[model samples]
Target: MHEERPEVGVGPWEGELPSEGHYDPELLSNGDRRNVADKYRYWSMEAIVADLDERRHDFHIAIENWQHDMNIGTVVRTANAFLAKEVHIIGRRRWNKRGAMVTDRYQHVRHHPTVEDFVVWAKGEGLAIIGIDIFPDSEKLETYELPRNCVLVFGQEGPGLSEEVHQNAEATLSIEQFGSTRSINAASAAGIAMHAWIRRHVFDQSV
Candidate 1:
């Protein structure tokens, strides 16, 4: 008979484990196999979220969820990886969470009944709404300097942004695709846009 290999996560704790408040006794005893990073192993879900909250970036991610878009899950996961300030869902509160792989549990998410409501919230937070879609007046993302405090808004998967949302945006930007396809997947586009912001506000600045 073949022996089962060890779990992908850390082994059960030995002597002198971490502090009481930070670690989860169940996880520590069973060996932490959550999707979180190694430093967060054995850490309580609340502790991990609190730690992430302390370092989250100024930028937020909002998705137009009129159709319960599957891409919203991927966007949430990516947002968590990039440590976005929050993830906003517009038009619908329910979305497919399969792609998020439980990362949504650690993310701060809010729902808006409509684009108008989302715009109002953004305005209240003093965040500039930058839509990610290509149009006649849209600027290439490569040339645009993403604001330090802004919400990168993505629209529906196929139709892209609604006319009203497009019109209300302070500015719209698009990725330059070299392929014959007119557009890429919505989640991929969101990831690219977030990376662009990170490139300018985080990576490049640090260098």
Candidate 2:
């Protein structure tokens, strides 16, 4: 079962409001209960998005949606958590958004009709496409030093990355598993891959 949401909401303002452009009058009066951090309470959506845009990492997330994979929403939500520069959907334009929990509103998402189009765009943007999946020749994610600026690509749930994506990607990395299962869920893999990038580019830099 899911845990309960917080009961507390931002209380009404006590004194004169500041001149800063971040505050929202309506939210200040009517408790802000949005699914956001305390720091963003009572702030306009525009303000929150602007703040996020300033610090989003350079890496991007791309997923295949040829089969209308339900995992796409989860991947988009995870990308938002990691603050990826953008999320690219290759194949179908519309996708199931139920798993995203509205986080897609804060994310920058794009669509590509085909793998060829995605590859061409990636090349033009100078961002290397690194496929995430398990294969005989795939490198271990634990040791792989991900590209500083790259697009992390994922595939549909059951099929994994298409042969076209695999061939076009600069390299593919796989997460090691010990159990009898051949692979983890695509959404889980996407989260792990994104966090792996964070560990290398964001977390490692502070130390």
Candidate 3:
């Protein structure tokens, strides 16, 4: 026989129910089972998004999805954790969200049909486009001083950044590798890049 699954989050509001506008009536009456911060356990989804918008980091994250990369979901989840301004998806409209585990519901995700459109949008937003990939002119990501208002773009799992994106990028950065593998995972690269930004701007730590 299969084991019974344990429930997540809190079970209903204990004692006096809170009357805050952010609190969801249903979740308070029933239970808050969504994977969220303790403070936001009973908050409505819109409230959580609104609060996040007020304090989202200046840096943005973009990923290429020409081949329907599965890593985008993980990238979104990481972006949410880091409170990224937004996640830009270049190429396909739909991507595999299993890795995100429903974090997308609280994170703002935008889609671009092509690289050209993405570049146009980034330029309009005054965000520098920094690509993460290994190329002849790629600089070490560790040494790179990521712009405060910029979008760190990553290619799909296999091909890396497309030629168009590479050409349009302000700088293509590469994470230093030690052992056998030539490159790291796309989602992993995104996390590293996002943390680098956080270290630089949020905690005022050198990357």
Give all TM-scores, in the order shown.
0.95, 0.93, 0.95
What are the lDDT scores of the predictions, listed in order? 0.92, 0.92, 0.94
Instruction: Output the better candidate (1/2) by TM-score.
Output: 1
Write model 3 residue lDDT over 34-108, tens digit each, in one string: 999998999999999999999999999999999899999999999999999999999999999999999999899
Candidate 3 residue runs with Cα over 4 Å from true position: 1-6, 205-207
lDDT of candidate 2 over 74-144, digit per residue (tens): 99999999999999999999999999988999999999999999999999999999999987779999999
Off by over 4 Å in 2: 1-8
Q: Give the TM-score of candidate 2.
A: 0.93
Ranking by TM-score: 3, 1, 2
Give the TM-score (vs. native) of candidate 1. Answer: 0.95
Which candidate do you rate higher for lDDT, 1 or 3?
3
lDDT of 1 by residue, 128-180 (tens): 99999989999999999889999999998998988888988999999998989
Better TM-score candidate (2, 3): 3
